[model samples]
Target: MTDTAIQTRQREIASEHLLFKLIEYVEDRHPGLLDFLEQSLDHLGDPADDASKDDAGVRAIAQRMITGARRQGTD
Candidate 1:
């Protein structure tokens, strides 16, 4: 493989590892949060929804996920 391909694969693996850790942490602290996020994402591509709403939803979910993952305590 080329140098760029190797780097890309390394990054993908690292990202997957980090994502798994985040999911495990989130699940342990707040069960069912991932499920709710999956459902919310499913609606983002709905024909009834406008581009602005989709953008807002994506941003909201990203913010919530980041905040939720880093939040301390049982909150």
Candidate 2:
């Protein structure tokens, strides 16, 4: 695969790992958390179209918000 394709696949794999690990950690306590999250996304979502570096500033801000929230371990 090309270098870009490899990197993209790596990012997807890593995202999947993080998502499943999080579900496993809290599924027992919440019981329906997985279903809740899947359902909630229908109400809250970003663009699903192709992105470009032209929006890197907005993307970077969103990334920081997510990473910062993750560090706090709670909303």
- Give the Cα lDDT of each candidate: 0.64, 0.57
Evaluated against the true structure, the overall lDDT of model 2 is 0.57
List model 1 lDDT by residue over 8-61, tens digit each.
999988996577577757777788876666566545542445555465566575
Worst 10 residues of 2 by lDDT: 66-75
Best by lDDT: 1
Tens digits of per-residue lDDT, candidate 2, 20-69, equal 55755676556666456544443453444656433545555445544443
Error of 1 at 24 (Å): 0.9
RMSD of 2: 11.0
TM match of model 2 to true structure: 0.49
What TM-score would every model get versus the actual structure? 0.52, 0.49
